[model samples]
Target: MAATVVQLTESKKHIQHTHRVFEEQKKAFRSNTMPSLAERQENLKRLKRALLTHQDRLLEAIDRDFSCRSRDESLIAEVMPSIQGINYTLKNLAGWMKPSRRHVSVLFQPASNQVHYQPKGVVGVIVPWNYPLYLAVGPLVASLAAGNRTMIKMSEYTPHTSALFKEIIEATFPEDLVCVINGEADVAADFSSRPFDHLLFTGSTSVGKMVMRAAAENLTPVTLELGGKSPAIVSPDVPMEDAAQRIAFGKAFNAGQTCVAPDYVLCPSDRVQAFVDEFRSRFAEMYPTLRDNDDYTAIINERQYDRLQGYIEDARAKGAEIIEINPAREDLKDGTRKIPLTLVLKTTPDMKLMQDEIFGPILPVVAYGTLEEAIHYINERPRPLALYFFGYDRDHQRQVVESTLSGGMCINDALMHVAQDDLPFGGIGDSGMGHYHGKEGFLTFSHHRAIFTKQKFNSGKFVYAPHGTAAHKMVYKLFIR
Candidate 1:
């Protein structure tokens, strides 16, 4: 078919372009192995300017891509964080770049030791569709701050945003210093397989596995920001209204299309109905209506829309109580891809809603008899990217913090930990690995090279040639003991 031939031709062209840009970035990084502090700051400043200038355009593009992404949501979730991240990086880049002095061992007297954070050449960022601009720009800021040339791979699912992002990036920086690649799954596979100095991927865990496997072929170090079933635990004593309001905001923001969004809530058995009621009330207050609410965001596409709908049906069929919080009770099935904030009660372990990451406006409330039971439930499963506890008791908070392990945690809050400019954001186990944001971001993209300086000392030489010398014996006796 002619369509098939054209598709093949386009694929081939995208592949070729990716390869060419990757080589160009590597070559550019080679020429300037370490950029000065002022240079890095300037680069970030330029990026900030571009973002501010194209803020409206970027919002429109993202809205078009998602069919009905809220303009304010896009600005808050994507644009604001991106610009703020750049500002954070610019302010702290100089301190981050300074070589850190290390204490030398007594055995190596008269030697100075330090670690030099050098750039890791070219960094490849594979952005996901959920929060395309933030994911792409977050890692790009870190890579640039670390003085590395970068090539970004925008998600094909968000074609409008991807094209606009590529255009903006190209207009701002030279192709060799910064490049953007737009293509489908095959192109993403090819991009991951390329020999980038470092790669950062943000997406689903399954696709993250494929990206990691591809990067392994080149031995490329990766920072994966994968998503999982992040859970929030509501304490028996904490005000249900307080916990519900926060969790509702987390779930309803961008219609819950967030990597760190609360996937489910683990509440005390007695307060299940109370917690659900509060959540429903808070969500209704936030949206009030879904059909024509520009404040609410729609699912990204029909496929994703169908997937979430199927989840509701599957859970319903499996004996879970379904509660749809449509305040106005308007018809949302008019091809708008808008789904009200739905709650699934009494979800079983085997249900798809419980087993997988629910990256939508669906929240499942699992009732736990006690705090220990809640902790046990979380520990029995793969570690999540984020964990939330909503109790005011300091001892209980400490117990929760000390007992569980996750990429990040929030006490008395949800999803706000990620917005903090100073905290390092990442995941563990199935959720994800490695970190970015704050100083960790700079460190992730940098190669910490140890440096030892010995001016005229021969301390190492004293024990180099002779095996049984007096100095060696003294050294062994004094320090070894």
Candidate 2:
């Protein structure tokens, strides 16, 4: 039998509906129809209230989509941080909204120059399936805070959760100011093609290229978050067990269905086996039974499951050892897609896992004899989204941080750096582009209009006349000065 394919469709209705919605938002933004601070606060508070009320529902929907996402993980990854983003914007909007003062040259002292924050009219967001609510609502929160209209293209992989989110938003806000589109890639293509003041996309590098290409038709500014093979480097000084446990927890989270998840481990060669053994033991303890555990998140859908399964099988076929200290497998109606807690040994830089980003629950340990070799290996690849170093030495950590460039970093732990709302989250080069979350997100969705208020200064008239006389000499001196 031939395989089925996923592609964009010419769905006239979805396209028309999206165009109509964008048109409405464009009108609303032109009229400045969204609520003010007090009103937005109340409305966002209400939305947060709804989220709190439907917390369990959110968890259930995510669980349905991913098969094992838990309430606690959802809360920490999606709900709580989303609430924090809203609140952070709420408290700081007034300050962020203030027209920032600018320095004026002494020669042009009479003119006052300042930069004012203005809404970018309409903003479009293309959200990814992993952390659906967070990626979708995060930019939404920023746009809401910035007094802009927004429309989000929710991922098809998590249709249930997307529909639920739409219901939540529909119940709370006006359609023109805030809207959600439910469809597949064609819908997203249409969404990106529409004329918007800005568009933010969170997805793979290939998809990001398509989005950027489509957005170019409308001349819409975009924030593209792409993915790459992020590395985790464990120093020789740290305890192997502790490093393994921390990395195992991060790698196993969401079945490694994270954009910034550590794709491979580049560690000291002498300690590689020890690290692998420790990771196996720790992962086994953490996820005792993948079929029963709520914390063990599944792949977003079968397509992803198949892709990951392919990578694993190919790795095994090519002479890689798959270590499973605690096996979690079962035959299901969905055709047994579980790749429980995989740890690969004898993995060279040439393997598929090493060559490409592994967005699954597989941990491949890449061994090195020295920190320089590890550094060389990581430096040779495209800059990663996050660089992880686990050790007790602070100076060594500084050296690593100084020597390498990544979108973000963490010492002694992984994925924790992104949780802190203070740090700007983003990747560089092939991994991704642009930063968001916290104040950076606020700025990305806004336009800092350089407003130069000028008084009645004849300096313009003085320089306007073209002549080789005293006026020209004075103007030339002024220009020189």
Candidate 3:
């Protein structure tokens, strides 16, 4: 009973803290409604410097949280992309901030139309645990680029990294300009419920729905970067060795915890065994051992580890052949949470592995007799966050691009599209709702307020009143047609 009282008190305190910081940011934003190009550029430069300065600490902290996340992976996937995003924003922000002129209709002569990109007062970003630093910093970069102050909420599962990130952010900027919030699910709910000009969330689809519902209370706009069963299609013509190696790299990176990781592979039916064999060989070459290999990352926690194990056990029990790619045949019962690259073959739709997003190192290889069958299989399921097609044929690529829909696609590659600073990153339908990264990100956190001006001429006055005068009639007759 006493614990319940303590819990309520702490909840109230968190709510108060969130509100206090939000109001402070609001007041600060009102003081400088529109920051100049120079100011925004300086902010970006400072952010880049801070990130680089703390790069080592961030890598270590994330490593601690994940038990043993690969330092190189953290640098390549998290830090490098963040710095590149900032550089891209700095390069294009000046032109992006300029008001775009629009053609005024003849009927509205003597008037000019243009769109002014203005900052939304305060933005809320809810970061996920998968890529703690990248997810938090990515949205923060876009928010600051748009001249809006941001309050970020980090995932509780990554306590070490979240705390370290909070320190980095505090040292980098004043709290009123940008701040970080750390807590559990309840705290996240409170953070999302607060009225903000815009909100961005990166996590699973289920949690995204709850975040959207909370945002709806204040009619807050949201950009959800959710995950799904993203698939990689291996064309029959492509060398099994080439396709298998690339797919292995994608699935093995970060232990396949990435939101856009290739969830499963659709390989040619006749080459299923060959692809699996090549995948196993390629993965083995990457890491000959798992438990002691620092290059291999552990599952974030026991719960996630057990969840993935459960998927494999369930599939095995349901008659799905399980191939554990442990080249060294190391016993996994040790304290290390590293699970080998397990492949489930002959999988049926009723299995949980097929029903859910396997956000782990587990890969399911489904067989398809023809290209149309592969495309149809993907189309029947929920649209994925990313789709990978391995082929040199331009016509097949074009057909895949036109006939199906996904947030992003990679031709003859995997997981590289999200790294492009110029392309928008996001999902569609059940996967997610919106796009961010590069210009789309800046626009997401901004309000493109449309404006029209007249040069001391009341041309609209002719159509204003007097029950449709001759001028109005003429204007209407000309434009109404």
Candidate 4:
């Protein structure tokens, strides 16, 4: 009881500290509300430099947090995207910052219209554990590009990575310009409650709700990158071998911890067994051995490991077929948190694995009769973050793209859309809301203030007279008609 009281006190102190820092950042934003293009670019450059300088340390720290995070996967999925995002912002910041001109109607020809993209004061970003560095840096790139002061709240699950990120940020920037906050769930709650110009959170849907509710008190606009059961559909036209290999890579990468990872596969009824066979073969080709394979990432923690194990157990009890893909058949009971690539077939709707976002290397394959059936299956559920369709036919692709709704869709590919710098990445409905990446990200953190400029000529004097006069009637006829 005493310990609990002490913990609560500490939590309050942490929240207070977060609020204090937030105030300081707000003040800084007020001082320089709209930073010049050079300043914003320099900020991004410094961030890129710091990240590169501490790249090795960051990767090692993330590995420690996950017990065994794949170094190559970290480079490809996290580091590469962060660096690319910075470069993309730098390459286009000048053009993005320029005021865009808009045409004025003929009646208002004497006036000119333009939109100035101004920073939205301070921005609060809450980073998630999976792909921690990428998620943090991605939003930071957008915020800086939009010329906003930022405060980042690192996830508690990845303590080592969070601590290291804090060190890097403190060394590269001032507390007011950019600050990092670290704590548990209570601290996250407090951080979300604080009023900010804008807030961005990347995590689960359930937590996203609480964050949104807290932000609602302050009327803070948010960009939530929440996760859901993102699905991948294997069309009958595409080769089973090709579809299986791509889906396998997407699911196995990061041990299927990616929010955009293919949660389950929809294969044609006749191709279900073929997909299973091809997927197993492809997974083996990627990682022949699981226990000692550095390429195969382990579950983030024991709790997560146990949760995944329970999913398999419950599915088994429910009569779902479970295929554990341990090419080497190594014993997993020797204190190893590694879970072999698993495929759960014949998954019932009542099973927990089918009900929730399975953020592990567990692929569930569901059989469908036709493409429309596949589309219907996805439409019935809550919108997903990403949807993958593997087919070469442009007509079928167009149909799938138009008929279904997802945060993003990848046609004839998997997990590659996010790598494109020109694309805006985010979710829809239950998956998430708002967008980040490319120009959309800059817009998300910026306020597009529309401005109208009138010259010495008063064209509006025609309608400014008291009551309806000849000039008012003439103006009304000229414009309204």
The Cα local distance difference test for each model comes to 0.92, 0.81, 0.92, 0.93
Worst 10 residues of 3 by lDDT: 460-469
What is candidate 1's lDDT per residue for 28-147, written digit by digit as tens?
Answer: 777889899998999899999999999999999999998889999888889999999998888888899999999998888889999999999999999999998998999999999999
TM-score, every prediction: 0.99, 0.93, 0.97, 0.98
Tens digits of per-residue lDDT for model 2, 91-148: 7777777788999876666788898777788989999999999898788887777778
| Candidate 1 Cα deviation (angstroms), residue 235 | 0.3
lDDT (tens digit, per residue) of candidate 3 on 1-481 = 9987887787778778889999999999999999999999998898999999989999999999999999999999999999999999999999999999999988888899999999999999999999999999889999999999999999999999999999988998999999999877899999999999999999999999999999999999999999999999998888888888899999999999998899999989999999988999999999899988889999999999999999999999999999999999999778799999999999999899899999999999999999999999999999999999998788888888887888899998889999999999999998898889999999999999999998887888877767667887888788897
Clash count, candidate 3: 0
Model 2 lowest lDDT segment of ten: 1-10
Cα-lDDT of candidate 4: 0.93
User: Weakest 10 consecutive residues, lDDT, candidate 1?
Assistant: 457-466
Query: Higher-TM-score candidate among 2 and 4?
Result: 4
Ranking of predictions according to lDDT: 4, 3, 1, 2
| Clash-forming residue pairs, model 3 | none
Task: Kindly provide the TM-score of model 3 when superposed on the true structure, using C-alpha atoms.
Answer: 0.97
Cα displacement (Å) at residue 191, model 4? 0.4
Error of 4 at 87 (Å): 0.8
